[model samples]
Target: MCVSHSVSPDFCDKVMFLLAQEHRGPLRGGGGAGRTAQEGGGAGRTAQEGGGDGCIALEAGGDGCIALEAGGDGCIALEAGGDGCIALEADGDGCIALEACGDCCIALEAGGDGCIALEAGGDGCIALEAGGDGCIALEADGDGCIALQAGGDGCIALEAGGDGCIALEAGGDGCIALETGGE
Candidate 1:
């Protein structure tokens, strides 16, 4: 198994393990719960905890699901196992998630200033949320129930593309909100 960034092999193993923990559950794009992934030994907290790197802390809280913990700047938590589900997270300032990938399901969250969540991805239900100043959620994607939510000033929620339930909500002033297709 090839690990990205500086995540320890042991930590990566644990994250892979949790990805399939029946209790951990799957990360269904933007409208689900579960926090998985870490950087530089930061630790992956379930969506329930609602804090930490690669965490799935949605506005609607629930039983924290899964998270891959790590300790490093710009670390990428990539686990390619688990009933066709993959969850990745990045920590520190200005971390970037998947920018261009098609097909398959991906749940990516960035917790830092000027971080980029999901960008130019295709297919499946994609949910990308960014937390911190100047964060960008989803930008130019295609066909899926895309929901993009960003928190902090100068944040951009969604920017074009996708043909499904597109819900975009941004926090703080100067934030943009655009919703089209479905409710």
Candidate 2:
């Protein structure tokens, strides 16, 4: 869904796109206002380029939101500015979630047999939660906060921070948490 520039600030609200197959190109959900949700095999670019003030939720094998590109059997989410929030949840044999933004809050949850949650925030905050047989959480960026939690077998958390990185893991399986500082 695309909104015109003349539209009001609250023009877009709670827009959702669901696809069973793969979505190529960019799938727009709101030009400058409202919430966007996409669920399916995934999408290449889920939102408008540059930046916009909106919320996005993508759960697919490709990607979600702005410039979101999810891999096979993966979920990706992205948001621009203006109190934007992005949440991605993947459920498949192998689930993966990817999120990025400078001022948006990103949350990724992957639940399946082998789940992986990856989040990156620029001057923002990211939260990654995974569950299933083998769960892993990876995060990177600066001036951002990352929280990772995994359950099941072979759980690992790795965080790379441009400013600071935080990681937390809990489960009965083998778990590892690693944090790295900026360069």
Candidate 3:
């Protein structure tokens, strides 16, 4: 087990005894909820969904989607393996989300904008808020380049990629990039 809540099953609340599964939220992502993973540390499985009453987390082999909120004010989240999302209408309200893709894309979407991320390959590319600006920014864990933000300000970039971003047009202008080694 890569990570566990307690020492033994007697006290373990969320102890993962597998290797083909993973969690991808604030617990490991940032501040989001409904964390999930596909190929981290767990036995091979397609969609083994589990959690608490308030948890809407799901997992799969192709993709994984986990919406931060929208169910209520608590922390409504969902995760899958093929897209990982809580679409606009389904995202509910006050939704915080963190998305990732093993192929070549990862995203964290919020209406007002309040999230962070850390991507791997992603074809060496990164995209912040597709609609607004970001709070804290830094992209330096892609291929070997840095990416640029859309058109706003405060968006930072380190060893990330700039496939589609405008200078000074992004958001945040934030972060001490090139220093850290992850997205």
Candidate 4:
């Protein structure tokens, strides 16, 4: 792997391990109440669960699959699942998420006050979203589709669907939108 800036030896080792286990097998985990689980698998198969305040979970599963989740106040999650798919989610105050699912799909979501999300689903699709005060979003669905959106005061959105379709929209003060569909 390459990076723009220098990294510590420990960071490099961790990154190497993560890359090396991309084609190993399957990994799964479950956390107890008010606990968090973090796991990494080989051959791209991983799953994890988290509960309680400020919890985080991360997993890489299946053929380049990954999954991650976080719960309670100030939570963050990241996951990559299925064939080259990834998913991330966070809930409660100050939440952020990033996810990719299905065949080369990515999805991200955050809920509650100050939330930000990015997601990609279906075959070759990309999506991003943000909610609550000062929100922004982007989403893409279907085969080769893309979308972006933002909700609440000062928002922007973009969406695309079907074969090579694109759409953009903004809500509240200062808004804009661009949309396209079909082949």
Candidate 5:
């Protein structure tokens, strides 16, 4: 099943077709002013958009669950589990937070002044964050974990455990701190 609010009919149809092909249950899309929330089940995917001063939240579960959000001066929070993947983009001054567990992957991009925080646990977890005049904090645990952060006039803090790897690249005035434990 597919549901869309404040979005074009063509977009709704395309989302339905894509969900059907993937055999994933349910797709919800919302746009326009105010806050929006999108949730999916059974390895599903969700996308949301919010106008000025509006926030968006997305959550999903099961293997291959994905969530994407875009907004302005509006924060975005996404949470998923079990091979979950999430991507977030924020315009203006807004923050993005993403958390996942078990083979998770997350990417966040912010325009203007904004911050990004990402946390993941278990095997093969990867996270990337990029923004301007914003801070990025990433933490991952277990094997094969990787975290990368890049920004200008921002600070990056990365922590990993057990066969973990972390990279940080900052342009202009910025600080980078990396920590790893156990191999």
Candidate 6:
């Protein structure tokens, strides 16, 4: 999605890269002009995203751009184009995003670390909980990332390298089903 701003008042002559892609500049592009963002003049600059409920709103400063942007009621959403549609975020902080319901929240970290915990509220859903040792984790403490459960082998008998996925944990006793992803 390359957009040129020859008519906009901003870029007089010097090329400037719009780090965040929400409304583009302080304003939205509506003049029938779009340019590839590859024209960003310089590199290694600081950028800030204005709004979004998630930890990552825009990935303009890093790799992978956004796939789609749905400014519904101002609550930035992804387009309904379905799968196979890849609107790359400027950065790749987290994957699979769901709206916060009741009190459920999912946190993600791109390079530093991943979610410290993913919890559901009230009696909503225990999608995450940090006290179990099943193949899949319902919760996680701030420990090994990219390196799954290296904290206390008592943690979850990890096979080293697995995502600490809640898959096996999601199903207990193989089929008895104590509670998917839960003990």
Q: State which candidate has the highest lDDT.
A: 4
Model 2 per-residue lDDT at 10: 46
Number of the top TM-score candidate: 4
Per-residue alpha-carbon lDDT of candidate 2 for residues 31-100, written as tens digits (9 for 90 to 100): 4334334444333534322223222233322233343433334333332332343434344445444343
Regions more than 4 Å wrong, model 4: 1-50, 58-64, 181-183
What TM-score quantifies how close candidate 1 is to the native fold? 0.45
Model 5, 1-183: lDDT tens per residue? 111121246733743453345234232235543334454454345534333444443444545555544354544544455453443444556555444444434433444555554444544454545455556644445455665555555566455555645544445554765554555
TM-score of each: 0.45, 0.39, 0.37, 0.62, 0.42, 0.20
- On the 0 to 100 scale, the lDDT of residue 20 in model 3 is 16
lDDT of 3 at 170: 34
Off by over 4 Å in 2: 1-87, 95-106, 118-123, 138-143, 157-167, 177-183
Q: Which model, 3 or 4, shows the larger TM-score?
A: 4
In order of TM-score, best first, we have 4, 1, 5, 2, 3, 6
Per-residue lDDT over 1-183 for candidate 4, one digit per residue giving the tens place of the 0 to 100 score: 221121235744743464345224332235455443555456445556665554456555665555666666755566655655546666676665766665545456766656667666665555667667766577766666667777776677887767677777666777776777567
Q: Candidate 2 clashing pairs?
A: 12-34, 14-35, 41-61, 62-70, 63-70
Per-candidate alpha-carbon RMSD to the true structure: 13.3, 13.3, 11.6, 7.9, 12.4, 17.2
Residue 74, model 6: lDDT of: 29
